[model samples]
Target: MLFRQVTHDDLGCASYLVGDDAAGIAAVIDPRFEIDVYLDLARYMGVRIEHILETHNHADHVSGHGRLALATGATIHVHRLAAPEYEHEPFDDGWELALGEVVVRALHTPGHRPEHTAFALVDRARGEQPWAVLSGDSLFVGDIARPDLAVDRVEGARGIFRSLHEQLLTLPDSCEVWPGHLGGSMCGGPGMDMKVSSTIGYERAHNPLLREPDVERFVARSLATLGPQPPNFEAIVSLNRGPLLATGVEATPLTPRQVELKKGEGALVVDVRTDQQFDEAHVPGAVCITSLSAGFGSRLAWIADREGEILLVGRDDDDALNAAKLATAVGIRRMAGFLHGGMTSWREEGRPVATIERLAIGDLPARAAAGELQIVDVRERREWDEGHIPGSVHTPYHDIDAIPAGIDPELPIAVLCASGQRAAVGASLLARHGAKHVLHVVGGGVGTWERAGLPIER
Candidate 1:
């Protein structure tokens, strides 16, 4: 059996290319919206992609199954319970598919989603026993899939407990375990290991959820570890299950005047430059979302409307193109155009540019000592609870609109996250909302603050 795991570092998701060399046939599982990787792999491996499989209706990122099927003429398969609106072959429990010497068997593991399935690969050439299992969102290297995505928390947790213990744990200890996600993915708990793959024995011994056999205990622990779900999860799931849309929407170029007009007409202006470049000077009211950030698409999806028009602001056409592709991958399809020559052209044309103040980490002590600065920690709730600057307001970057209620716009406000990227985003939002004094903490975030032996509230 030939196997290759493709990792999307940005989203922390993994896709698979399993094939039989002799048979010249392959299968792709849980692919992202960008299908070029699978096509390129098939061309290089001297194999034909005949089957595209989806473990479940994903809530995080849009699936590429529809596009891959059209490109390779492969049949798309999903669990019968998913009831996907798209045309697909519905496989059920105990269903087995033969690809040359490798047999792909479907195990109905409905927890993360009601129709979630884990595929086991059996190499008939070696033995009847399975060699590995593609545990999609059902199990991870060190953590179990979060069950609250598709169903009620308690109900889904119970289902996940049964699915892991009965179907997955029953596999041979030596069988290799491949999951759908890794570290940085929101599909599971925060304790997920960075490794892309693991063995059944390794997970069985080290996985915290499996250590507790009691269903009640497992459910309680799973519930306690559940973090914030992706902001656009519901909309993403709806798009994944319904008819697939065009993914390669090329960004059109527009003059600064055109961009300004569109912004006035309610189009979202997304500035895809570095945090520093954006902070120095940018189009007023534009949201700062760097094109190179790993979570660029997800972050943009959380703030921008799915159906609203998006006007790209980048360094040049290449930057705009890349940003458009990233936005399309996450199902943000209503891109109007990109600024023709970017901010440089906007500034040269005598258009006004807005600037946000930057605060150095070293100077924070003096500002705090003065008791005049109001600091806002824009990290997640879990991170805030772990440790944060004392008296700092906890407002997540996605929920920056609430600043007016908890903070005074007239006071000097500073924002910080785990890193400086999110703080820049929050600062930009605050400035756009007419905050009198907004500071973007540059050098470092909570990590630097802690390392410097600064006092932490919690």
Candidate 2:
């Protein structure tokens, strides 16, 4: 049996490919919208993809079922209760999928979604015991699924509670459980423990959701605490209903000359790069928003207008594709296009640029000596207590939201974080909150400074 788990860090989704190499057939489960990865893997493994399966109508990230089936000539299988408005094969609960010696059986595990199902892989000859169960959204590794979903909203929580008791808790204790999501995804509740997958025995013993008997509390809390809506959800899922686009956005690439034209027109240019690279040099009016290449599309959707025609600047081919995906994801119908040759070509073509001031670890000593170094660490509380630069003020990034009333917003503040990501987010907040002087440390270089024997306000 050949099994591989593909995890996307940005969205925290876990997709699986289970195949029998000897049988020359395979099944892909819970894929993303990008179809190429699975195609390449199947080709490299010298096997044909025979089926595509989805555990539920996912809410966190877009699933790549349509494109996979279109490209691989594979059949899509879902639970009979789903009644998906697309072409698919409905498998009733207990239906079996056979691939040579490998067998996959579906268990109707409704709750997270009314039609949810978990697939259990069986090897009867190897033993009557099962090998692994793709728990889908029903059970997360360290967290049982939150009952809330989009359609039915709170009532769905009640459904999920019933599903857990009826379908999952009865599984063999030794069943190796593989869930569809991990930590950091909105689909699973925040109460989720920090792991991607765990055995039934481990979760049954440790997961608090399993401790509930009446199921009423489980339904109520899960309903009350659904995570932030998944970014670009409706549009992404809707994309599947149309003709499949090979690349997500399919926007035309623009030359440096073209990007310059957009900037001149006052378009908000975004250079999705690391802070160090962005600090080194950038197009004059661009901002860096760090996210996975493909997932960046959703982030872009948040900042840009629904029909905004904007310029995208990125480091490479994947970056450009991701930028386009962002445009498409957020329903931004118009993309003037991406910077054609990227920043390098822009500089080569004599396009003017700007540089963000970067501060080094050693610079802190000089600032401290001069008596105007007001450090504002924009990390979470857990991070703040972990150890921060001495004499620094703490303002967790997300919480930097509210401009604390009566506090001097005009004070010279240099936002610092573990790295540039949170720092950038903090700096942007300060800038928006009417702070006249806001700068962020290029990297959280305090640790380096301490390692070099610099004085810290212990």
Candidate 3:
């Protein structure tokens, strides 16, 4: 038996490849929209991919099941409740698939989504007892899946409670628990762990949610602290359920002249460079989404207009292409292309540019104290609750489409997050939304403000 876990760092999604190398057969679970990784792995292992299995219809990112099936003539497997429109063999609880000595048993764990399922892997060569379970969105290393994506919050919470107690926790303590998502994913709550895998015993003993014995309290607590849903979640879910989407997006290289025409035609330009580089100079009205972190896909999805086409501007061909791929994975399909020579070429051609002015945290405190600046804390609610500047208003970065109430457009508005990355995004959003005086706070945020003996409003 052979096993490999493939993780998409940006989305914090995990897919699995389980196979019987001796039998020359393999199966992929929860594949993303890129199929090359799985195909390459299959080739190296000298096994033919014969099956594609999905624990549930994903709501966060597009699945590459269709493309993988088309490429390998593999059979797609999903739960009957999922009711996927694509060609698939629908199975219910206790459904099992055998590949030589490897057996996968489906546990109907409907919690995160109404049709969610978890797969338990049993290597018969070793023993009849199961060794690992792909918990899907049902369980995580430190947190459990958020229940409100596909159904009502309370109802979904109730379902998750039962699913955890009746199905997942029933597994042996020795069983390895591999979840569908990690820390950066919106699928789980804030307490989600970055570790990819954990033993069932560890989670059972240490996970906070798992320790709650009461069902009603579990339901209430589960629904108490969910973050905002993923951007375009409904559309992403619909696309994942409606049909099989193919991969292979070739971003055409657009000349500076072509880029200008597209921009005039209402294409949104996304600059995927470092915040420092983007703050230096960029195309006018372009939104900067630095692709250096795992939040790149979600950040782009949050900022870009889904209905409009997007033109990517990056440091080079590879950077632009990477941005395009991440965009596609999140269902942002209306890609125009990428700039051929990047921003340098645009500057050489004397194209107009825009630069966001950066302000250091050291100066922010004094201006904020003097009531001369409207500091916007664009971090999350939890972060805000822990610490924030005295007069700053809290508006999460994702929700910065308009000026917050009581904020004056004429006054200098400084945007700051944990670091300056999100502040760059927030500042640009404010600028595009017609905030006259926006400043991107660099150096640090509330933490730095507090460390420097600056006053903070708890």
Candidate 4:
């Protein structure tokens, strides 16, 4: 038996390659948009990828099953409830697929989505009993999947209750549980553990949601704990369900003049440089979403309109290519290519550049006291509720598409988050939304202020 888990930290998504070495056959579960990883893994393992198993039609990121199938001539398997347009073997409750001594049995766990399934793995060579379960979005390490993305919140929560109690819980306490997502994924609540894997016994004994015996109470609690849905979530789901979309091999390299024209024609110029590099200089009106951050793909998706074409400005060809691939992972595929030679080429051609003002947390107090800056707290609601600068306006970073009311474009606006990474994102969004005199509050955030003995309002 052989198994390997490929995780995309940016999206908190995991895909698995499970196979039988003797049979030289393997199956991939919940693949990401990039199929090369699986291809490389299969080649290295000396195995042929014969099956592509989708736990469900994903709503957060596009699946690579189509591309994997095209590359390997593999059979794609998905739950019938997905009604996917791509050719697939529609699987349901109790369906099983075998690879030599390794048997994968599907447990129809409909909770995160109506079509959600958990695959229990059995090594017949060792024993008939299953050893592990790939609880795709049906369960996380410490938290269960959020019951709101696919169906009505109430109905989905009810499904979650049943799926947890009747299906997953039925597994032996010793069975290893590998979830589809980890911490930082929007699919679950704040309690998702960063640890990669957990056993059924640990979760059953320690998970807060599992303690609720009453279905109504469980539904109410689940709905109450829901976080903001992933940006363009519905569109992502549609893309997954519709005809299979192929990943692009390369992005066209554009001259500075061509990039300008694309921008004029409604293309978004996304600068993927570091925050310091972007703050120093960038294309005028470009949005800064530094590829340095782990959540680069997600942040880009959050700010970019699904219909708009993205024009990437990277540090170099390699940087630009990586940025484009990350963008594709989140289903933002309408790329207009990248600026050749990056910002350096633009500067050589005497193209215009812009810079954002940097503000330190220590200086923030004086600015607020003098009414010289309007501090826009771009952290989450919970973060803001815990404590915030007295005069700061609570506006979550992802929701910074428009300049909220009472925000004066004339005044210098400082965008802030828990860390400067999100602050840079918010600052860029503010600039794109036509806010003049935007400031990227770097160095630190509200926590910095609090730690320095500055006053805050709860």
lDDT, candidate 1, equals 0.89
Ranking by lDDT: 3, 4, 1, 2
TM-scores for the candidates: 0.96, 0.76, 0.97, 0.96
Candidate 4 lDDT over 1-458, as tens digits, reads 98899999988998999999899999999989888899999999999999999998888898888788889999999999999998889988999999999999999999889999999999999998889999999889988898888888899999999999999999999999999999988889989988999999999999989888999999988887687788788888888888877655468999999999999999989999999999999998888998877788888888888788999999987789899999988888888999999899999998789889988877878888887888899888878888999878988888876897789877789888877889998898888788889999888899999998998899
Q: Which ranges in model 3 have alpha carbons more than 4 Å from their true place?
A: none
Q: lDDT per prediction?
A: 0.89, 0.71, 0.90, 0.89
Top candidate on TM-score is: 3
Question: What are the per-residue Cα lDDT tens digits for candidate 1 across 347-385?
Answer: 999999988888988788788879979998889898888
Candidate 1 deviant stretches above 4 angstroms: none
- By TM-score: ranked, best first: 3, 4, 1, 2
The segments of candidate 4 whose C-alpha lies over 4 angstroms from its true place after superposition are 247-249
User: Candidate 2 lDDT, tens digit per residue, 1-458?
Assistant: 87888876666678998888888899999887766778888999888998999897776565678778888888989887766667889988889898767898998987777778999988765876677899998888767676655456656666777767777777788888888877766677766655767888888888777776766787665655465455555565455434443455566788887777787886767777766677677776566665543345445554565555777777865686675664543445566778876778888988777655566545766775676657777765645665677777887655554554433666666767775566765665655556666666764455665676775553
**Candidate 3 local Cα displacement, residue 37, angstroms:** 0.7
**Which segments of candidate 2 are over 4 A away from where they belong?**
191-196, 220-226, 240-247, 264-268, 291-298, 316-335, 348-420, 426-436, 441-458
TM-score of 4: 0.96
Candidate 1 at 99: error in angstroms?
A: 0.6
